[model samples]
Target: MNRYQSNPLSLFGMVLWLLSPGIARADGHQVSDPMSLARDLVHRMTFDQKFILLHGDLGVDFHTSKKPSGAIGSSGYVPGIPSLGIPALQETDAGMGVTNPLNGRPGDGAVGLPSTLATSATWNIELSYAGSDMVAREARSKGFNVLLAPSVNLAREPRAGRNFEAYGEDPLLTGTMAGYAISAIQSNGLIATLKHVAYNFQETDRNFYNVMIAEAAGRESDLLAFEIAMGLGKPAVVMCGYNRVGTVWSCQNHDLLTRFLRQELKFDGWVMSDWGAVKAPSDANSGLDQEAGAQLDKSVMFGDGLKSAVRAGVVSQQRLDTMNENIVATMARQGMLEKHSSSGQPAIDIKGDTTIARNVEDEAIVLLKNDGNILPLSAQKRLKILVVGGRADFGVLEGGGSSSITPYGAGIRIKADGEGEMGRRYVDYLPGSPLLELRKALPNAEITYTDGRYPSMAATLAHQADVVLIFATQWMVESFDAPDLSLPEGQDQLISAVGAANRNVVVVLETGGAVKMPWLHDVRGVMEAWYPGSGGGAAISDVISGQVNPSGRLPVSFPRREADAPRTTIPGFDKADGAMFDIPLIEGADVGYKWYYKHHSNCLYPFGYGLSYTIFSYSNMNVTHQHDVTVTFRVRNNGRADGKEVSQVYGLFPANDGKREIRLLGWVKSGLRRGEEKNLSVTIDRRLLANYDTKLGRWVIPEENVMLVIGRYAGEAEIQFPLHLQRAEFSSLDMVKPH
Candidate 1:
């Protein structure tokens, strides 16, 4: 089979009359048509003025990129023309929250939302939307009109440095969650960007590597994710990758930009290059609409260089016109041209936003193991508890990178290793100490704390206490991926010593992605509190103290060891720094659990896997496939406690090679009272069931016996039903809101 068998705003006019602050929430719904306004303004713009919209600069002086006068210092800034009433695009690093890069705005900070992996774990679309809306509102209030986030990139490489920024491994889950994030952010009149298109998977050699993925594999895995997100969110801007999509840089790849994104998927928004990603002026012809952070490039690829190209007929007038139109139309689509930004912007409500963060993590923190059901410890108990390590007495751990958020109340910083951003990769710790929160949660328990730097000291305390609680941390950052799955900083040794010393030990993990638990056999319980955000400590207290039921599932599989990874070693990890290397993505559509399923190997924890305090059973399975697939099942809470359940459905299809391909069709998160039975239904998009036929350039579901594997996690056979499917091909994907 050929590689690509399957896959895949101008409202500019209204001026001052629409500038009322109260109408800031107004979107294109309440504004004049965007395209009409853009087309009309295209004729009014001067020849030189049109070039202004094609490039932007890294608008901060963190490392000598001079910001334009009156421009907000941030990740990227496009100066607006006062004559045209075009507002400047002030973009901030979001996805986690609005990060104060280098504490640019002193005393100003954003509310930290849990890592995207945590949200991906929640499997809750409504929760994702609410959290993103809160962050978007905060960004707008802080004078930023664009959020450089909602990265819909698939987690093709588990060890990839940017995995924390993405929405898990599955294309459907990542795309759907990111789509909601886009919609929520845009609804607040701020642009949410969907980014890092086409196999920008690993961060090692990110700026120089050339990814040579099979056309079909590229289309079905990562590109499918970008496609699904575009259909739902309709984002105003799409950020191209820094690395090459094949031999051609993604910013200048005509097949990816013009044919796939612009033509096939009907993505009308402008394509913005990742900071410093542009290669040449001819990138304009290949569908790159704008060069972001142009100062980061060796030479300005768009400003004077692009002008020269157009003069020499290397870039056509039509391409430049389209680029200009897209920029203006997007500004209008988000009501940016209509609404004026105030320098005296309202202050962010950190307290209110933190509440939203807590609510999200309340359902997002997964209970990996509750052996002997030892969790939900009673507050009235008089037992002595030992709190060890992870700086639990100080603050919670968070991954370091562009997405790391500065705390509004108080931020803790520990200088870390690396050559990132002027050798300033500082490890951040969110406020709200887990030890203090636990003290409040269990007022009667006698609790003692230890830093856990000395394993012997932690072991001694663990032996003296009736029960032990260890807060473990693993820091995953951008620029460099984790070396292995084991906990960093000798944390596993500390955990092992403590686990051996205590009869009852419960571990709370604050990490960026999956980690190996060498002491799993010694621990009584394990809770994955993935960078739980602003309310992280309190959320951990709520779950362990029985205040909230745990429902979050694993978005990515946890391998037994790094050796079990799809790629044992990162591509070009040992290669020369400035030399280009080839990255052949051989995994194809099988990523995360799919890879494990194909190998018939068992991971530490499977995708969509989590343990809850209460028991729930699935029964009365019914499947109907007509226009689409609908799965209805009855969920009954067998335990006496009320809880929430996430029922996952995986599709099993026969492959031409006799092996089968497994994909996540859909899932539903339902709430159930004690002993109550509820009927829940999940509608599967047909495109998810169909494979991209590179030959036909369409999604096809070949005639075969398709089985629906419905359970809490992949491979679990709670309810399995088989139905034969007729060959169905779709020329287009329906981006309708999922049920």
Candidate 2:
């Protein structure tokens, strides 16, 4: 007769609660509390039901139709149990943004967001969060609970095709930014995944390439970022990449999947495979719970192969149960079952969308070089300008593939004067040119443009113009990474030809990432206008016409030549065997600015390098805590231009031998008007000073002297401060957090 006692009637009620479809709604409890419901439902599921959930509902229309199939077949969704009312969980593609199919465009549904490279340049966590929120809204609205995003991969090579979709080369920056983005999406009642589990840097033979990396290098640069995101974001899902290390593929590597990701990193979410990433059936035995983007070849995700493995004692039933438990737990964490019954909200607000896109584009447009102070062009006069290049009239903005976005309306276009003929042939998939937008901004200017491919034609136009703006674009599309860093064949030739005819030339480059600039010396001005999304034309015009000062910095290192790249030793880069190159990663932990700083090699441009219309100075750097420091500086618009300046803070750790070297720790962006000075402060944590020691098998902090550097960018003249650590042994966990 006790209230808490489970007598016959009470036991019957508990059983009824376990099987009731209406229990969640009948209890008047919020559906958002999926964990509680999942715990209850999982206890009642049969072994077969648990196995089906773990392998995912593999159907041809899974991502498209929002349906689940019991078996791994390319057909309509086959219900696991019609009477049980257990709906299947569906996932969608998204490293940059929501990838929905549109008019036969595979994986195109909603208006995608900007690439990771563009977001990284902005260096604004809030912007990334907003973008992810939009992607989540779109994904949910399209009937998908899992939104795969925040691809936290390292940008080790400049020529990597996927570079546009990754944050940057630095582990701290990439992890922090990706973590914020994932958190934002997941917090909105949807699940955001952190992907390419480890060391999937290059796309060349991505499906079968062997990424030979030293354990130290992988831990320091690649794995460090993944661990940061996992600890901070706690993504609902982790997608395994299609790369191999030593002899084990990532999807089939027990050491990586079980020992590292699940146990060491303490990740409790389900691990899914990249499209066709699982090479053999045994891959699932390595702690992978699901096969996402499952193709037609894998006949039964949880059928014959799994049954055979269990019967043969290759994979125990306990392991299968554990995997299923993880999947069910993740589904509960994502509120998949509860949210599945309701409809979703809209993807974006039209007005807010354009404004955010423009702001991000403005922040990401890097001003590389400006001599004679020609930038922020005087808008008072009807300047005679000539806009020429293949991508001038039709803007070459944003990268292609899954990250591509189609804005609500036609983006702002640059306008030009005279008989300028826009390129009729669309060679690539980018949006319109900046010329149309520039023309609209400068209606009074007498502008003329011609296809710069013809030297004589460009010469004739340049001779008659007072200023020439050349749009040099590099389009690196799908299934291939760039061969070299050089500008396209015709672009380099056109720049050289036009520069000879006109000294007042402004080169605007539209590329996914860095490209070698052989003609940098010839042009008077340069702008690294990365594929600037939909409103790129307007952003370019604003920078040129004194409306917006360029504040973007080089997120990745710009090598002076292709040979300067660390991966250049890999031969047959352009051939089919290019994906099979066996070159060693001798550079190891020293990548990007690290390599340049250590070796004292001259680069075309150092990482985080950017030019502003104004000037800023660093001083009064004070170390408050042994593990933390706050630096105060002054940024003055010395130039007679209203613009913004980004103050970069770098930290240098003295080697165990007492030698001094500097590396970037953190940075802040500030805005100021002409002749106005603004005070700025930035803090750096002690953990940013740790280095991975191969012999020690852990991150080590030198007990010797540590130097603090504050500069405009990497390799610049830096203001220095010194400190000493009493103890040197510090784990990555201690370093990421301050005392």
TM-score of each model, in listed order: 0.95, 0.85
Question: Which residue segments of model 2 deviate by more than 4 Å?
Answer: 1-39, 56-87, 101-109, 296-303, 339-344, 406-433, 569-583, 627-642, 654-661, 673-680, 693-698, 732-739
> What's every prediction's RMSD, in angstroms?
5.6, 9.7
- Report residue 106 deviation for candidate 2 (angstroms): 10
lDDT of 2 at 690: 72
**Model 2, poorest ten-residue lDDT window?**
1-10
The count of backbone overlaps in candidate 2 is: 22
lDDT per residue for candidate 2 within 1-739, as digits (tens), equals 2221122112322343242222132224346544455556666776566555645443445344443434222211223333344556655555555543232234333443556777777765556766776666655665556666778888787888778888878876687678767766776656667888777777666666666778866777778888766655667778888777766788888877887677566677778777666666567778787765544335555556676777688878777666666765565554444434443355456456545666777878788889887776775678899998755676555565545554444433232222322121112333545777777777788877786778778877898888999888776443457777878666887888888888899998888788887777778999887777656677788888868877787778888877777767323355474255443566666667777776677888888888877776555566665445566666566777666666677766554334445566666666666777666566654446677776765566666676666776787755776767565665555433210
Error of 2 at 615 (Å): 1.4
lDDT of 1 by residue, 1-739 (tens): 2111111100110111133111244543554567677877877888898888889887677466556666666788888876887878888989989877766676777789999889888888777888998998888887888899889777777777788888899988998788778878877778878898778878888888887777777777788888777666677788898888768888999998888887787776788999889999999998999999898788888999999998899998777888988888778767777645465566677788899999889998999988888888889899799998888997788878889988877778888864645277888899988899999999999999989999999998888898899999988888787667888889899888988898599999998788888899989999999988998889999998999999999989988888787788888788897779887776777888888887887999988999999999989999988888788888899997889888888988776667777899888777788898877777787778777888988888888888998888887879999988889887654542211
Q: How many residue pairs clash in each candidate?
A: 15, 22
Query: Model 1: residues >4 Å from true position, as ranges?
Result: 1-29, 339-347, 418-422, 733-739
